[model samples]
Target chain A: MTITITAFSKSPDQGMGLARDTRVRWALEEAGLPYEVRLVSFRAMKQRAHLGMQPFGQIPTYQEGDLVLFETGAIILHIAEHHAGLLPNDAHARARAITWMFAAVNTVEPPILELVTARIFEGDKPWSKERLPLVHDRIRNRLRQLSTRLGDADWLDGSFSAGDLMMVHVLLRLRLSGLLDEFPNLAAYVARGEARPAYQRAFADQWAINKPAAKAR
Target chain B: MTITITAFSKSPDQGMGLARDTRVRWALEEAGLPYEVRLVSFRAMKQRAHLGMQPFGQIPTYQEGDLVLFETGAIILHIAEHHAGLLPNDAHARARAITWMFAAVNTVEPPILELVTARIFEGDKPWSKERLPLVHDRIRNRLRQLSTRLGDADWLDGSFSAGDLMMVHVLLRLRLSGLLDEFPNLAAYVARGEARPAYQRAFADQWAINKPAAKAR
Candidate 1:
């Protein structure tokens, strides 16, 4: 059965692929799977129907026939589990690939989110100027450790899997911060993921919708 | 094969069982699996060996034979995948259970962590009072959505799975704020999870180690 997922009617990111559905879309595109998107306003997201699908009323919930899934990690993992090209065939390698997936979301993304919060939500706070450098340093610490581990390797692990997909997405959030430039190898790693034809298609698709909205305003 | 997991050499929470390792311990107890804990200091968590195991320099990493896994969601999911009782037998039900696991971490925990940051890290700030409500409201909004979906339902889905384990743990963070008291149903839901003997045993085990440290100080 074909799948359907949800996204912001008007994404806050303005088509930067930071909306997370971009990752799902990119993954599906990479897997050569066609899918549908249902736009959810902030209001509709909290409604009974949406809450039935997503406990926390967040975006990019996946549905296939009677099966409904939420949480970007879970949704992406579900897709990778049922589809090909997203995971390796070997058992040990596959486990390692899944490890990377967890690392991306659970490990890498937290500091990035902290950076976002400091910049966006706490921007006006007096301490933001002082606090941001600490957050940036934390991010750099993670990047340095990751860069060290990933030294001279193309992907975090062997041949790209869902883990690389997630790590790339997590790292992409650093683009505007310019901190990514500090780690050229990590920057190139993100570039490699973005350069994937599937990623390009997904980016173009979402960007197509986003650019016009920006223009109208 | 026996499994080895990490815990705080002395938890900052004293005996409160708020530490991440307690979650893994609870999962292990619930699964009726035997395991050992390797208490690590903050310094050890950042050391090369620990960093090799956990990229984020956090706790509750799982090690079995040659397999090592980090991220509580990933670890719990792995345990649930290998052991029965943590997942439903039906395919669709299983997917939904896993979805809740993601929701607990990605959606619910972020706002709760905000509350932590505000209360602990930025408590001295002039804007702490104003920002605290915003963080609390964000948490309440999540709980409201969750409470509405739960209604009179005992568990999030059919049976108690690792998903519920995660959801309960995430919700438990709000206990001190009394915001959880605002949702009696969710509070009771958390109570039920805590009442589990497995949870009790896990709590005591961690507490046994943590309590003395608090007293010594």
Candidate 2:
């Protein structure tokens, strides 16, 4: 079965590969699976067709034959579960890896997401300047804990798994904020993730679509 | 293997069962698994021992034999994968169910968490009153999409899988805000989740620990 995943017709990030689709694409690349991309405009994402596939009407819905899955974590996990590279063979190790995956999204990413909300959506608000520091502080708190746990480790757990993939992507959002630089280990960690052959391929694939040259074409 | 989990020594919700441990307990109950709970105080949670088990220093870490797991979604998923009731048998349905679990935490809960942050942490800010409507509007946007998808369905997908278990728990947070009532189907969906015997048992168990009378004892 050919796997088909969705991406933004034109990513708001403009080829930075920060979009959620990059996560799914990276997972597929790691799994060595061939997949196709279906681009959806911001408008179509809210329409009945796309909403049927993704309840939240978000980009990056995964489809293979009769199976349709949304949410980047789920898509990545599904790919990881079916393939060998993305998860460990040991049951306990695999469970721990999955735990890291959840921790990345639920515990760690929420604060980082709040920083995005503070900067983008509420940037012009009267309190944005004052509230921005608080959001950054909260993000730093999480990063501090994460950095402590990660201290000099190559990946989150033993080897690179979907957990690391998800964590690196979540941390990528903080790059522009300069918070990621505060923790040298985490910054190096993100660099390592980006250094992966799979990640590079995935990044280039999305970059083709959102690149200014492609837009001009 | 004896399954042991951790909970707040005294939940901030005061027995309302909004804590993450409640979700883990609910999953265990639905799976018909008997487990033990170890309560940890806020100060103790920040100490080395608890922080070792949970890197983020949050409650609801699961331990069985040599395996230790934190993050309620991961714990519930671990239980559901090992046990019977919380997931479906079909592969595709199971993937979709897990998708909802991620959706609950990643997509749906983030805004709800923002609401909590606005109300509890930022309530004293000069911009609290003015900024709240923006936060509430963001939540309403998600609820609108969710309510539209739910329509007349009893669950997000079918047969009351882990997806419903998670989505219901995420929506439960909105009850105090009165936003849930705006979407009648969503309100009824939460009611159905509450009516479950497993959920009821989980609720009562936590209530026993955090109830005022029990706290006095």
Candidate 3:
């Protein structure tokens, strides 16, 4: 069965590999799966076909055989469940890993996203500049806890798993805000994730598509 | 092993059951499982003991035997995976259902939590009134897509699985904002979820803990 996923035809990240398709691609690489990407322009992403695949009109929708899955967490989990490399064999360890996955998106990402909205979407608003510090603080609170938990640890739990993959990506967004630097351990943690062979391959794949176009423009 | 979970000693919602614990409680109920609840004060939630179980220092950690799990999405997923009722029997369907769970928390709840932040945490800010419309519009964008996907359907996917349970609870938070009312179909969908015996039991339990305290205060 051919595995196909959708990504931005031209990513707004401009080859930074922050776009979520990199997450799915990273998971596939970690799982040692060969998959195809179907690029969708921003306009086409709003069209009926793309909306049918991803109701949220976002990239990184996955398909294999008859199964179509959206949501990066779910896609990563699906791959992790089917493949041996991304999850632990121990039942309790696997459950804890999944807990970290949820913590990454739900608890950690929300504040980081607010920072994005503050800086990008509403950066021009009258409040954007004023609100930036508050947004940063909110992110800092989460990072403080995360940094405490992750101190001296290679991963959130034992060994690198999908949990680390998700958290590292979520924290990578903080590079622009420079918040991840406040916690040196977390910065090192994300650096470790980026250094992973799988993540390097995924980053390269997204870069291939995004970089040339960025230069052309 | 006895199943134990934590909740707010006194929930911020005044017992409307908007807390994440209710989501887990609802999942447990749907699975026909009996569980014990331990109440954690907001101060204690930040303390070392609670933080040990939940790194983010938020409630609704699950403990069974030696395994401790936090994050409502992961806890509900843990229950749904171990139990028979909360998930579909078919593999593809189960994956799709889990996608909705991720969609609920990752995609849907982020915008809603922003609304909460705008109205509650930053309500006194100079820009709160001016900024609220943008936040509301962001939410409307998500709900519009969700409404389109959920058109004339009883659930996000087939049956009343954990996905619906999650989406329903996520949407339930919007009731305080009254945004759910704007989309009649979604409102009805949430009503259907609330009408479930399990959700009712979950709600009543939280209400019992919260309502009398509100009156006394």
* Backbone collision tally, model 2: 0
Off by over 4 Å in 2: A214-217, B214-217
**For candidate 1, lDDT tens digit of each residue in A106-153?**
667877888898788889977678778767987898899888888888
Whole-model alpha-carbon lDDT for candidate 3: 0.93
Backbone clashes, candidate 1: 0
Among residues 3 or more apart in sequence or in different chains, the pairs in candidate 3 whose N, CA or C atoms overlap within 3 Å are none
Interface RMSD (Å) of model 1? 2.0
TM-score of 2: 0.98
What does DockQ come to for candidate 1?
A: 0.53
Record all residue pairs in model 1 with backbone atoms less than 3 Å apart, i.e. clashing: none
Full-model lDDT, candidate 1: 0.85
lDDT by residue for model 3 (B45-118), tens:
99999999998899999999999999999999999999999999999999999999999999999999999888
Q: Write the per-residue lDDT of candidate 1 for residues B1-217, one digit (tens) a residue.
A: 9999999897877778888888889888988999999999999988989988887688978899988888887788778888877899888888888878877887778778778877777799776776677678878988988888788888999789888998899888889899999999999999999999999999999988988533454
Better of 1 and 3 by DockQ: 3
DockQ pick, better of 1 and 2: 2
Sliding window of 10 residues with minimal summed lDDT for model 1 chain B: B208-217
Q: Assess the local accuracy of residue A19 in candidate 2 as a C-alpha lDDT between 0 and 100.
A: 95
